[model samples]
Target: MDVRRIGVVGLGAMGAGIAQVAIEAGFDVVGREVSDELGTAATERIGHFLTRKVEKGRLAQDARDAALGRLRTTTDVSELVDCDLVVEAIVEELQAKRALFVELERFCRRDTVLATNTSALSVTEIAAATASPERVVGMHFFNPAPLMPLVEVVRGELSSDDAVATALDVVDRLGKVAVPCHDTPGFVVNRVLIPLLNDCVRVLDEARVSPEALDAAMTNGAGWPMGPCTLLDLVGIDVHVHASEALYEKLRETRMAPPPRLVAMRNAGLLGRKSGRGFHGY
Candidate 1:
């Protein structure tokens, strides 16, 4: 399917970034938020992002304006009825996502591709809630979606080949590298990355080394751009805990389990950069 118009639900950090990406990629994008205030905030956030790109000489002012012109924001879910592809980037809870997809299936065309940007939830479970499970797929974009080059095109057990192909095509049009993976917890990147982050948490809990030292070891020794603690902060400690818990529940592996310190941090409302504290202060 030729996806000319895209709908992005939940205009949070990831959703706004995804919407910006689609707009810059020359797609007419309708971004949905739960309220008018949030919709406005998302729009402003996208504008700031584009303006920064222009300031950095990465994007021309005219190009930025054109991309902004093609984008619209709405509080109504019905605004997405005309979108060729609708990607849900809402809360990571299963029931909430399933509810949104079920509602989308009610209004969208039979062939309209419905995608979930869930990092750890079961795509199959979400798809099962819709009338046409074959049309549902997972399009897991990394954090800071506009800048991330990798997009995992996940195929649920019931996802149609055509759906997967269409998703991959959309990813290609956005100038991203698309890797196909099955509907497994964490898909691929988080499946491996989260475990490593958990291990880093364990090391810290054991008081083996300081966060700075551990991060330095990874960045200087392993040549990684950022260390685990830095990445965890960026990814949100609560998000890491949630993803780790989900993986552990499914895989029954200690490596996938979230460390006690991580859970404690989350319970204490120290949810990383967004919350101002996590493994380390923001």
Candidate 2:
């Protein structure tokens, strides 16, 4: 398929980053938000990101301008009817995704690929909402989509080979590695990652390890680039909580249970760097 136009549903941090990266890779991008205000906010968010790259000499001003030129923001789902692919990056709720998929299928072409950016939810379940479930697949990109190299090209139970292949092609065109996996709760990365993150919180709450000490041990002893604490903060504590709860609800793994501290932190609105505070001060 000649995939030239990309539609990104939702304009949250991950959605904005995905849209920016797609535009940077020379695709015509239509980013949809629930409201015009949110559409403007998403545009400004991507603009600020591009501006930062130029200020840091990481992106050429001309390239930035050209990429921005290809980006279109919208508040209507019907505006994405012409998009070759539409990726949903909305809230982590299952009903929300299913409802959006129903609405998206109503407007988009039957062949237009619909991908979900869910971290742990069942892709098959989300795809069930669409009449053409074969076109619904998981295109799960890690946080900081611009910097993350891996894209999990998830094949749902009913997802067709062509749909998965299109997703892999899209990932390649965007200069990212694609790891195809069968649809499952959390697929692969988040299956293991969410549990570990939950344990990290448990260790802190139960073992009373200082966040600094725990982070140092993981960074030095475990050979991790960033410790759990710092990583949780960077990835956002609420995201971890959501993944934890989702995984636990799906898998019923005790280790995947959301820690009390994480719930408290999220309730307090300390959502890592974006919120100015998290496990560690940003």
* lDDT winner: 1
| lDDT tens readout by residue for model 1, 1-282 | 999999999999999999999999999999999999999999999999999999999999999999999999998888888999999999999999999998999877788999999999999999999779999999999999988899999999999999999999999999999999999888999888989888888888587888889999899999999998889889888888999999999999899999998898889998889988776886
Instruction: Candidate 2: list runs displaced more than 4 Å.
Output: none
Indicate the worst ten consecutive residues by lDDT in candidate 1.
199-208
Candidate 2 has which clashing residue pairs, if any? none
**Top candidate, metric TM-score:** 1
What local lDDT score does residue 10 receive in model 1, on the 0 to 100 scale?
A: 96
What shift in Å separates residue 55 of candidate 1 from its native position after superposition?
1.3
Q: By TM-score, how accurate is candidate 2?
A: 0.96
lDDT by candidate, in order shown: 0.93, 0.92
What lDDT does model 1 reach? 0.93
Error of 2 at 182 (Å): 0.9
Off by over 4 Å in 1: none
